[model samples]
Target: MNRNDTLVPQVFADGFDPARVDRSRYFLSLLDEGRAAGLFSEALFSLRMNELMERLAEQIGLWTNGRSSSVMQETAEALLNNLLYLLDLALSAAPEPRAAAAMLARTPVFPLYEAGMLAARRHLDRCRVYELALKKFEAMVLLPPGPAHFLHGGLRLWLDERDLRFNACEELYVPSSVFGRSRRLRGVAEAEAALAELCERLRSNAAGPV
Candidate 1:
């Protein structure tokens, strides 16, 4: 946790770089080191998570006027995953990985859960309009050569499934693809607009002009 202390050798100090090493192996090595240093405990983490899950499920049930236990449990699990995802983002962005891990270990679980829940609420509110837009987009079919032409034009678009594909001739890309440019969808409207533009292009190509 000290600024003066480097956690590992300089080679290992940098965060997970796929080109340099395997991601799972790198994280596993770090996890082993943290466990050895008493900075991590599977038992303690599990206990805290279990407690948080129960509390979250109960609270969600109350808000929903008592949903089935199975539904509440699944929802709580998803929220917990969201909280961990935020924690992962924090760790990845930290300049001091060792100190970040130490701080994470020292932090209480509920505060992190609360923060994640608040973030989810804000995101849902911001994207609410996009919800119906995405649904409508999903229902439409990208007739014939329209999809091919759109991608072949070197433009990128996000699908409702959260995958971004581009460069129609060579390959379709997913999140893990090492090639092509990437952009996060600002909202469902962005994707919907892209599809609408593609459809309009099809109409123009078919009819010559309006």
Candidate 2:
């Protein structure tokens, strides 16, 4: 197929029919190659495109699941986290002339995006802990408040806060006790480790050849 014909197929391949993905990916790939060759403009463009793709993926995941999946829910959660990371990288790499002003202008969207990401992350963490707890031990351990319990409680609070903050924006609210337990048990270190692993995987995927 010709370039124009390939556009639609590529969009479909990426799990969407949005007309922009092809052009976005094309320019993004060019940016990537240019950056690899030490061109700053291409690097900047790649960052911008990455930010856009992260947002698009997030919306698609939300619309597709409506916050219902137990297993696939992590997919949505990871999208937000990945977006946040990409945004951070993009902002950092942005030229000094425009970076501060541009990020300041986007402050309003940032908080909402962050809250959504944290909420999803908390929920997914809890779900994972819930499953692990159920499988590993029949009953709760009676030791002093440990990693598991702490993770669980933190998730519970985070989830509650997210609901309160974003209730207006969200279509539905789904609570999971499992997520809370998972948060408590996992601890910040473990959570960070997992997040790092996920980010690495996503970066690998994103950086792979088109």
Best by lDDT: 1
Cα lDDT, model 1, residue 147: 39
Worst 10 residues of 1 by lDDT: 163-172
Residue 208 of candidate 1: its Cα lDDT?
Answer: 79
How displaced is residue 186 in candidate 1, in Å? Answer: 12
Model 1 clash number: 0
Instruction: Tell me the spans in candidate 2 whose CA falls farther than 4 Å from its real position.
Output: 1-127, 130-143, 148-152, 159-210
> What would the TM-scores of all predictions be?
0.37, 0.27
What lDDT does each candidate get? Answer: 0.40, 0.38
Candidate 1 TM-score, true structure as reference: 0.37
Angstrom error at residue 103, model 1: 1.8
The window of 10 residues in a row where model 2 has the poorest summed lDDT is 7-16
